[model samples]
Target: MGLSPKSKRRLQRILPFGVIWFVIGLFVLFIQEAATGNKNINPNVVITLTPKVFVFAMISVTIIGLLVGAVEILWLGKLFNNKTFYKKIFYKLSFYTFFLVLTIIIVYPFAASIELGLSPLNELVLNKLSNFLISLDFLSTLGSIAVSLFVSLFYSEISYNVGDSVLMNFFTGKYHKPIQEKRIFLFCDMKSSTTIAEQLGHIEYFKLLKAYYSDFTNAIINHSGAVYQYVGDEIIISWKFEEGIKNNNWINCFLAMKQDLHKKANWYKNNFGLEPTFKSGFHVGEVTTGEIGTLKKEIIFTGDVLNTTARIQGLCNSHNVDILISEELIKELKPDNSLEVKSKGIAELKGKEQKMELFTVSRSS
Candidate 1:
């Protein structure tokens, strides 16, 4: 069976760390060669970079990287998910440094044996390994590993904060200039957020919102949705026009989100004393997308479709429905036999000169 979307995302995040470590390994190799020059400090400790030994060294560092990445994403990240940014970095750095030291102790003997054409259990190989570990070369490798870990942790934190897509865009300059494209957006707002805040108090309500959005992220990412913005109690998800309509993903994404929340209803009730509910509006149209700002750069979308979608979402409370979509967008969607869609009739929306037909969608049992 193919990996689930969530697992694919986790793998994507983990693999980059391995690549970073491999690159660092290459740099370390060069630094070591430069330091050793034409002579070895110990006559038995030769610094030869044979093709086979070089490949072995590269593979070793890569495996170390993959192991570290797995631990970071699966264990450390979750354990420190709610901690402060610096705290997360500090803990991860400390853990990675310790792991690096342990890796050197265990793997260096085997690697040295390969370079020297002797069994790792051989006395000369052991003596050479001991000399290398006590030499300045070992300290240099430790310094390099420490620097790499610190930089990598900082990169991961920034990537997580700005989001993976946005960071990629920044690095690639894909949206450096404004361009228009048709896109679909799902704007979801938590139901009774104001009342919930009043009931829970500021701190407790923020915690609820944090959990609520974190769960929503799983559903959105699984469905190939990009989180555009989080406006207080509302989250805006976006997709390329074709990507959204393919497999009716735009609609399925929302349904999946609803299902996810429902599955976690008991947890929310137990933790926050109430099960949170949400309403959403969907629309598709052209928008100018690009990187904006000098002091604080960001990618932003500007279009009337956003306003119309928000207005449609506002009608949900009045129409007493969980989801509302623009007639224009509904027409673009492929037929889904499992869906039951009803016309909510044409209505003049707020801040709009023309009226638009709206629809409410539900899953058929």
Candidate 2:
């Protein structure tokens, strides 16, 4: 059977990094062994990553790493996406604790066995085998855990700092030179945000904001949209023009986020004593992409499209709808049998030269 769309997309994300790092790990081990002049490093005479042993070690580690990747993508990623700040800290600690212990107890030994078994059966190897210095030490376990944590934490930090759009832009200094591209921008703002803030007060209001944004994260990621910014209780979501048009993911994401938030209504009521809602406005147009600031660098998108999108979102109250879309975006949206769209006529949006036709979109069912 052919791969499902979701599976194919997931693999597309995983394959390149997986192969790249596997090669890097192999070379690092080879160089480390070659450069070590101190013979007393391990004292325990054993098989090392000599050409033949490097192949076996690399294969073993790569397979184990892939298994970890599977768990990370399929379970850990989804599990952590919508969690509160404290919950995320707790979950990551627990996961790392479990993985560190497992790596020491199981993964290391298995890898060692693979190296020894695959090594040439020469006298030196046979002698090393008899001596079999497979002694487990506290230092070894601690060092391995330290290395594992470093790699994991570094990767996590980088991923958190760079949003999907930044990654899609190839993450180079190239954007600093200025480039123009068409993108679908969605301005999603919390309904009655000021009132909600006043009701909850400052401290609790911050927590409420965190929880609300966390809940919508999965919908955005799954729908291939990237967060552009968060202003007050508003979040700016964006997709490449083509990315949004394909299967109408940009529109579907808002609907899916609403569904997700609805499912959490009871939790919100119990925790915050109120249910929060959001209104979204979407449009498609060219945005100038460039890096902004010197000390605190960031990718900035500037254009009329963003301003127009924000104004459209402000119209949600007048139209009595949760989502509003500009004619430009609506024209490109692929027809989805599950969704229905109605023309909301032309409206002179704030700070614009011309009246823009609008549409209110929602699930047909």
Q: Clashes per prediction?
A: 0, 0
Give the lowest summed-lDDT range of ten residues in model 1: 38-47
**Model 2 CA lDDT for position 138:** 39
Give the per-residue Cα lDDT of candidate 1 at 123. 91
> TM-scores of all models?
0.92, 0.79
Candidate 2 — what's its lDDT? Answer: 0.74
List per-prediction Cα lDDT, in the order shown. Answer: 0.86, 0.74
Residues 3-87 of candidate 2 have per-residue lDDT tens digits of: 6445755664454334544765655565556667523365344445455556666675566556555665567766786766557
The list of candidate 2 runs beyond 4 A from truth reads 1-24, 36-44, 48-50, 70-145, 164-176
